[model samples]
Target chain A: MSLIEAPRTPTRGRRTGGINWEKWGWIYMRASGVVLVVLIFGHLLVNMFLGEGVKAIDFAFVGGKLSDPFWQVWDGLMLWLALIHGANGMRTIVNDYATNPKVRTVLLAGIAVSTIILIALGTLVITTFDPCPAGADPALLASFCEAL
Target chain B: MPEKSASNLVAEPQSPPKIRSPKRPAGTLYRGNEGMWSWVLHRITGVSIYFFLLVHILDTALVRVSPDAYNIVIDSYKTPLMGLAEIGLVAAIGFHAINGLRIILIDFWAFGAKHQRTLFWVVIGIWLVLLAGFIPRQLMHVFGG
Candidate 1:
């Protein structure tokens, strides 16, 4: 076995005139890396810098942010983009290291399943979150929610 | 046996396992081991940050479950143990971000590709300064009484 595996499959193999997934995957890493920096840093700054800093963070802080659709979309985008980016990176690593074809298939399947499930759950939470539910105890709700 | 050897010769024509010094194109410079180290670190930081992202998303999503539920998870992070972990998270993110920028520059800028070693050092220098600068402030926030 060589230190680096032969470039196989889509990167260097016979093609039947279809979309080049490997090329797109390469492009996706660079593109998503750029965006994740903004989404991630903005997230850190807001959570730990603005307002009263990390000390102010609690259910209310998160609840207030989720109440706004702007933050919801921002959070949702961060969720989807970063998850896919991470999953794709894992897939590349797995492909590079996994020597056995059957083992590789199983590993890739596991990644796909976990990534799909997390993305679904994350998207659902971000979009459907009701910071102040009708049935929740008034005492537990954010003060702003009490007005409603 | 003779037929098999003939087929092996044909296959070797394409796969060419022998060491062959291919011509360097008109004008290009080698980036050396420093370039290789940068590639290795980039991948390592990427994987580390991705792992952090997984845990982070799960914790924040707990907010939607219930206030008590979320508080249970988040409040635990205030412990000294988790505070120490925060330092590691910040370092991973800082390295990944700067190295990512280096990669982007190398990809787009013709000069960056030529001097990627220099760019890598620049990335490291910024990362150290940021990490050094962040430690005092963040440690205070994390472990401050």
Candidate 2:
């Protein structure tokens, strides 16, 4: 009779559960990174490169842009994407460095709270922004305000 | 060559035993399992945003410095092309914010791995809803409504 060696069993204390989370997170990073490259570069090119260049930026300029629906939508997208990306990125850092469970929890909570607050405030500013308010200090107000 | 005295044969008395150090198993800098890469990218983005914020604040402060200068800057924002630039900014902020929420949930709530797919879809849905509302409003402004 011939003897054969049996296959070795896996070591004890290995984590179990069917789902693979790390893989998915990695994929999310790459995918978001790709999209971010396009969005970020495009944003810089238009704001800094085009038109009269960097010197052309100002309140009336912003008011004028916001006055148009196109700019509003554009600004809105940038706000949403960058904020979420940043928040997600921080979450990753917290998970990696924060060893204590309680500490991790606190850190994560802080990130969430801050992100939500910023998003709410930013969106409000974009949607409710007034290019030309009534009865403002004439010197402080833009030309459009006076015209109104 | 003859048998040396016991004293001579004895190896020079070794230095008094120093405190023994504990053996430490090797630890990985990054977890080999899922999500490690994503976590790394998140940190990079967070730091980038901080830098961007400083610049943005300074630029906006220019308005307070000189209205004429501000108006010159503002006028540049008036073009149709500039409108598109704003779109890019909105997209960046939107994606970052929604993804950030996801990271928060996974870390704090102990959202199991199984639910990651669901959460991702939910984020996309929220983004779409916001975009829908924002786009039309922006277009109206551009068209001189």
Candidate 3:
């Protein structure tokens, strides 16, 4: 075993009943990774490179996309997948590096707590956002919202 | 010839005690079940998402600064290149979300692990279906206008 290896690095990780969570976790990483590549790239291409691209983004712009149920579902899925994927990856990192049991626990805890909070906030923003509020200063509102 | 002491000859090779187990012959690792494949994809997607997240949030935050500032940047997205890029993002999201569901099922559902391989295929099937639904509409939006 390497100096930092968990003293007993099971050739295979522990099991629960007949299940092996570690194996599953590993599998989850690869599967998610492959999918994320396409999702993330497509998202970037559309948002930053498509019509009007980055130059067209604004309160009106985002509001327009969010207004559509299609974009809503798309953004929501992206949020959940990215957050969980990131959190799981961090957990794996913590497991690999934080040899001290207490340190590992704390880091893992932080990852979980932070990830959950971000997911909640992001989802809420995507779902509940309004491009123009009734009482907001007209100056701040996008001109497009005037049509609504 | 030098005097070969028993201790000198015997101790040197084994002193480090390199516990070498027989390594698996190459492709055996890759030939494993769905779990292994999933793990690999998850790690890769996890890393890719991290990079995308950084850029996405930075741009999204621009909205707080000023509408004009944000719109200027987003306006660039209308190009043909970006439209093509959108398709790629749909494919990625479709696969990741479906695969993620499989994982969630394995964790929470009683039958998840037992039928994990079947579930794996189901994930792919759903992903393709979603893509089929999503692509044409997205293409029209991107290219038609």
Candidate of highest lDDT: 1
User: How well does candidate 1 score on lDDT at residue B125?
Assistant: 96
Clashing pairs for model 1 are none
Q: What would the per-residue lDDT of candidate 1 be over residues B1-145, giving only the tens digit for each residue?
A: 9999999988877765787776763333444466777878778977898788778878888877888888778887767677677767778888888888888898889998998889889998998987786666666776676
Give the candidate number with the greatest TM-score: 1
Q: What global local distance difference test value does model 1 have?
A: 0.81
Report lDDT (CA) for all predictions: 0.81, 0.61, 0.68
lDDT of 3 by residue, A1-148 (tens): 5678777667555554977777887777656655665666576567654765544555776777777898888777777776686778778878888989899889999888877777777776776667676765566576777876
In order, what are the TM-scores of chain A for the candidates?
Answer: 0.85, 0.70, 0.80
- Per-residue CA lDDT of model 3 for B24-45, tens digit only, reads 7444533666778876776665
How many clashes does the backbone of model 2 have?
A: 53
Chain B TM-score for each model? 0.74, 0.61, 0.71
For all candidates, the clash counts are 0, 53, 57
Q: What DockQ results do all the predictions give, each relative to the true complex?
A: 0.35, 0.12, 0.15
TM-score of each predicted structure versus truth: 0.81, 0.47, 0.53
| lDDT score for residue B131 of model 2 | 72
lDDT of 2 by residue, A31-97 (tens): 6655655665566556554654433456665667777898778767766666675666678878778
> Could you tell me how far off, in angstroms, the CA of residue A61 lies in candidate 3 after the best superposition?
3.6
Which of 2 and 3 is the better model by TM-score? 3
| lDDT for A41 (candidate 2) | 51
